[model samples]
Target: MSDSFGFGQRFTPDEMASIRKSLRDEARFGSEFIGRLKRVAKRIPFAEDLLAAWVCTRDPSTPRRVKLTLLAALGYFVLPLDAIPDVMPLLGFTDDAAVIAAALAAVAGSITQQHRDKAKEMLADL
Candidate 1:
């Protein structure tokens, strides 16, 4: 069967490779997200949304494909190098923010109030 109900349509080889890389980098996201968040929290305007996405990703009830998409964006955020190197002033995290915004828009319905609340709580503690 060629059906991909839960995951949408099948990916081409290059797309599949990127997905695989995202999955492989999930641990990196988990490990680096907090530290990176702390470092750039003051600079990033969307920290709450980012934390909500992280909360959604960790929720057992979240769909796998949603998790995959969020992880891909989160993974990109933590990468040492990306479309725009993240060390530059002002423009550094624009690409990361764009990627994250796209992922959140794609899975907006899946991110619940509970996730948002948890994210807010985390932000308060931070």
Candidate 2:
């Protein structure tokens, strides 16, 4: 059972692993991920969900496979070029929101209450 999703698309295990690695490396590189979320939350609908997905990436208990799925989603969020450009009014973040929703659905079981709480905490600060 592969946990890959993107606009009804799917990914192979190898691809999933690569995405996860990239996400991990990005996080290690800096805290810009959070900063980006904070900076865009007001304009990005489903921003809370994105924040929750991010928190899941940091938790020790989140399964590797689940993390991979979420990482890909986050990767999409951070990508400047995507299915839709992030500059159009009222439409910029829709693709990002969909990816986040798909990622959350793929790993809903692993997204615990603790993750949501932490996301809320972050959102409060934003």
Candidate 3:
């Protein structure tokens, strides 16, 4: 009955509420998070490679649904439109990070050494 099987135990109702609140507040903190992500993203040379690794690791071997979910989450980051506009303050990027983290956790097994290596290579600049 619990979400223990996925993403380190599904978030509790309270946790989910907190996450929602964080998203709401992110409008005020969006800029900071976006800046952080930009800094991090900039360090990685092969962002696509890391993303490929995430896809391979997180989704089931034949994961159509999970793939869609990941794509949607990724789109949320790249797209300008969302519940909280990316231009907001510190919290703007919290949701993006949370979603990406959740997706990564979901497919942790798929993220192999190769993926990590690629990420490391890209991030070496940082």
TM-score for predicted model 1 compared with the true structure: 0.83
- C-alpha lDDT (0 to 100) for residue 46 of candidate 1: 89
Give all TM-scores, in the order shown: 0.83, 0.82, 0.48
lDDT of 3: 0.52
Q: Report, for all candidates in order, the number of backbone clashes.
A: 0, 0, 16
Question: Which portions of model 1 miss their true places by more than 4 Å?
Answer: 1-8, 22-28
lDDT-wise, the better of 1 and 3 is 1
Local accuracy of candidate 1 as per-residue lDDT tens digits, 20-107:
7756755765768888888888888989988999999999998787877887788788778899987889999899999999888878
Point to the candidate with the largest lDDT: 1
Query: On a 0 to 1 TM-score scale, where does candidate 2 land against the true structure?
Result: 0.82
lDDT of every predicted structure (CA atoms): 0.83, 0.77, 0.52
Candidate 1, lDDT over the whole model: 0.83
Error of 3 at 87 (Å): 2.0
